[model samples]
Target: MRRSLIALSLAIVASTSLTAAARADIKSPVVIATEGAYAPWNLTDSAGKIVGFEPELIDYICKRAKLECTIVAQDWDGMIPGLIAGKSDVIMDAISITPEREQIIAFSNPYARTKAGFLTARDGKFAKADGTGSTLVTTPTLNNAADTLKSLRAKLSGASIGIQTGTVYAEFIEKNFGDIATIREYRTNDERNLDLENGRLDLAFEDTVVLMPTVEKANGALEFTGPAFGGTLFDAGSGFGFRKGDDELKAAFNAGIAAALADGTIKALGEKWLKADVSP
Candidate 1:
């Protein structure tokens, strides 16, 4: 009888431990991260509240997913690492999903599409050379993907280009036109755009969404020229980044985004923030 009791206690302990493990897995909630510095996407207001398009989108997605969610702000450089290290469940900070990042992380279906455009002064020499829209995606790099020197050397010639360091656009400019044009790196987009306005940099490359707002504020002073790039330098679209093996979470968000697109919620949000539709 004593031997039978010992076996029964062990079985009970094992059952309890298994139950606890299952509960842990089932109770884990999804947590999203974002960079508060990016405005209209994610930014901190005067009251220290993080608000923007991403916030609105995520809130709506959480409702759809039936997820108990929390949003945390992290610096852009650390957003991916945070996910890999399990510091956060996902990243919603307007980060463009690229092939390089997918090796270690996962992303939801792209919810926003944007084109790259070079912003220059309206009075600048390159003003009239700008293309219509989303030209860069289809425009193949004249040289290597890592180095487009041949393509940019002609347009830049002896000009100066300003880009925020650590940005893909900066990588494009330096790899391609470093030898031809003077390359200046800034700490932020606002700083680089300011320099373009101050005559410090001959050109600046930014997303059309951000560029239009700046150009509007500049009142015809800042102009975008050249073909806006997508695909390689840009991407298929922008989406929330998740940790590797989080395919379940990724799929959930993708479904929510799809629903948003189908019902026109995505377009409505884009129109609300960007005054345009970029959902795809």
Candidate 2:
């Protein structure tokens, strides 16, 4: 009986140690990856720190979720591959939730929503095209606006368009205007904007909230053309990306997002940074 009691106590201690180690593992800090180049979403500040709407939002989300997290800058092209390889755990770079992306990775419930539009030189011919001044939903298909699409095609036909690669805006432009226009993909928005500014490209397409700053700064040199587009195709909103198997991480972020939205934290931050209520 004495030997058996000693063995039982040893077993209990071993089990307790194992449980403590597991808890410690759970406490490890989550690593979040962002493009750090997209302004008003995520950008690398002059101090070499990543700062912007998404960063601030994530800070609140992490705290609410009781998640210890570290935000890191990453190239836009490598976000998914890095997440898959375990170099990062979460992606918060304004990734639009799309059916195509859903097949490869999981997305937390959307936190913010915005529309896409086209920008061109103020004096460019494309600038003369008419805009609907209202959003057109393009989820599932563009059938709702067949005539509008046709008109836009005729207006923008043969124009050289620039867009950041790996973005939903790029996919939209390619699918809608690929046949009618010359589409050029850049690794970053600044690169594409530079080409457009230098007359190397006729137009650029991107998130309207993102392009608005460029237009305002252009001081009459650039302007938005055509109506902004929404719906799942263009504005399903932005969400945090994770490996499909990381359900725990996704759940934590979903909860955090929900809490933030409920308390108006998201709306307040959106107004401060984007000048609009982007909360979904």
- The best candidate in terms of TM-score: 2
All candidates' lDDT scores?
Answer: 0.68, 0.77
TM-score of decoy 2: 0.88
Error of 2 at 162 (Å): 0.6
Give per-residue CA lDDT, model 2, range 185-262, as digits (tens): 887899988888888999999988887778887889998888888777664679999998888778888988999999
CA shift of 136, model 2, Å: 2.0
- Per lDDT, the best of the predicted structures is 2
Q: List the candidate 2 regions with Cα displacement exceeding 4 Å.
A: 1-27
lDDT, candidate 1, residue 112? Answer: 92
lDDT of 1 by residue, 207-270 (tens): 7776666788888898777666665455557889887777777877898898999999889988
RMSD of 1: 12.1
